[model samples]
Target: MTARAPQFCSMAWAGRPVAIEHQWIEAGPSNGPLLVFLHEGLGSVSMWRDFPSRLCERLGWQGLVYSRPGYGQSTPRPLDEPLPPDFLERQALEVLPALLQALGVDGTRRPLWLLGHSDGGSIALIHAAHHTDSVAGLVVLAPHIMVEDVSVASIAQAREAYQTTDLRERLARHHRDPDSAFWGWNDVWLSPAFRDWSIEAMLPALTCPVLAVQGQDDEYGTLQQVFGIAAAAPHTTVEVFASCGHSPHKDQTERLLDLVTTFTGASSPNHANI
Candidate 1:
């Protein structure tokens, strides 16, 4: 489960060119199923730590982990312009496909399984909804289908923390420009227009198998996030883990791994070999 060095891929995003930081975790077989790991808001490749490597090793699948445009060691967001309300949509629709194409990941030849956390999970859902044939399945952790009051309250607290506490200093360890990563996500989420943002309508369009996992004590969101997903995509399997928060991979790693192993095994039986 040793991790390799970070790699960079150049692409255009948000009307400007940028570089994305990424890594590949190869295991078991060269041609085994690929699982792409998407990080959360204010998250980067380094922030994921060893989760991708461990998951790929356990599942015997190849893994791809990356930092979105404004996060990690990749290109920083422009200081002058604030991100638009549809930023997440642009990431899923524009950034992801272009990056995959640049990396020679042809989903038609081999569809990819996405493992996304929080904001990343929302991106995965949007991508699958638009490109049904290119996605195999999805494992979404604390994904938001609709913005909740609790989400706003937490984000507001984060804003306060960023200004008053040492949160920015800590985030600087993961991101090249903490302001770019934090404000780009924070400003939009707390915006008046973004309050009405919802990807719930896109759920019914998803044809891939989905496993929505959430924590019972998540401060950022509620179980309604997964429940709304289940209501729309009746085929989805939903799990709410007790004694867990926004991050199941961090708080309940073992149980989360077991759940993913079982879900992926059933979804892609051939790829679960060790």
Candidate 2:
């Protein structure tokens, strides 16, 4: 049978309705586990290509892929509105739970795993830390635990490329409002105060087993990001792919998938539940 198309939905958060676009694929059995894919800083559901579906198939699990507000076909940000410094926090503390509830994902009844990239990785970390019981396991790729000058410089370069080149046009294909996705992500990273941003403190609270992966040549983050996660959560496993860049799955698809499949499969239910 052909897979079902994604459904568009909206939920109220902080007294405002936020649009969410999501695709769900049921695996072999209704009793099978669930895995959620969280995209990168400027990414949306469309940008993930077939990775989610492939990974779910490999793991024998259902998949949920969604674009957060201000991305993909989701609602656009208001022109005069300025997102709070805690935008990621809002996503973790407010939006995620609401989304889960709307989708009938009972965290207590069934196992849930998060596979997040970049900014989505940070948000997943925060959520797993605070809502310890809800998450079964976490897989993070090129996650930023703290702001770095290297990341800032790369983002600045991206901003310039978007303005003077066809980068905007390319992104437009994925984002419903490309300007919102670009600026919302760009402005925050380039802001001076955002330099001090870090989630190191929250890392210690992540009790579940984590699999953190990073590319050897990732322009936005260094090995330190993975090292920090391992240090904070010693149960965490780390992998670095040679000759890879910011996006490991895109850069080294076969190897990355192999690593993820092995790690997730080896993790015991007790460790995942912790």
Q: For model 1, state the Cα shift of residue 142 in Å.
A: 0.2
Which is the leading candidate under lDDT?
1
lDDT of 2 by residue, 109-182 (tens): 67778899998898889899998887888999999899988999999999999999999999999998999888
Off by over 4 Å in 1: 269-274
Native-referenced Cα lDDT, model 1? 0.90
Q: Considering every candidate listed, which one attains the maximal TM-score?
A: 1
For model 2, state the Cα shift of residue 254 in Å.
Answer: 1.0
Q: What residue pairs are clashing in model 1? A: none
lDDT of 1 at 114: 93
Alpha-carbon shift of residue 224 in model 2 (angstroms)? 0.6
The Cα local distance difference test for each model comes to 0.90, 0.85
